[model samples]
Target: MSVQRSWVIGAADCYNKNNVGLLIRKTACTLKPDVIISVDGDIIKIRSESTFKNHDTIFKLNEEFDEVTADGRKTKTTVTLDDGVLVQHQKWNGKESKINREAKDDQMVTTCIIGDIKAVRIFTKKN
Candidate 1:
């Protein structure tokens, strides 16, 4: 399938842990970033607002690619699509994080998990 779509920030939520046994502060709603996604065959390209640094990426499905994080950490990333969701994993410095994204009707939801932190970012289709 090949299609291109633009999404505007709708909302965000975060859940985190301060330490192994400590809960993070209350959910913080921050960083509303616009996004555009294009898919062609097994390749996908993503572009995000500058407010979200290091989010723009292009990769072929099921292949590991080199990527640097917004914080400047070099990581190996691999992306795959399962059912209707895009699942991404990034590994670096002996740690790993995951992001799951799904789009339906007019909205897209992304769930990100790292250590004890989890965040959900929502976006509405831009006309």
Candidate 2:
């Protein structure tokens, strides 16, 4: 069996609630940010592994979506697809900065596989 991997992008520790909200809003079709988080790009790897030296955008998972309260807590999170498939988060270890195979669901869900990540002051879509 092959292993799934995902790159760690902007975590809650790096970006504020507003920036995170923008990403979610851009991808959210009709669901509220409270119910869904969006992933962008193509899948070249699994969801449990990290795309080291890659440009893939990865979102850190947490127990809740409350930006005010859900800060710095490593917990089981869920992955949402554009088609409405909720890949529930299982478990992960944040101490070693390693990907946890236990956190990914068994179903195959296609989402954005981040490649290069650029850290800028303004986190928004420029036109």
Which predicted model would earn the best lDDT? Answer: 1
lDDT of 1: 0.75
Q: For residues 7-98, what per-residue lDDT tens digits would candidate 1 score against the true structure? A: 88788775454222222133134456678888778779887774534377899989999987554568999988888788889998799999
The lDDT per prediction is: 0.75, 0.27
Assess every candidate by TM-score.
0.79, 0.18
Model 2 clash tally?
A: 16
The stretch of ten residues in a row with the least summed lDDT in candidate 2 is 118-127
lDDT of 2 by residue, 23-120 (tens): 54333222211111233443222222222211222443332221111223354444333223333342334421111122233322222211232222
TM-score of 1: 0.79
For model 1, which pairs clash? none
> In model 2, what is the error at residue 84, expressed in angstroms?
6.3
Cα lDDT for residue 111, candidate 1 = 88
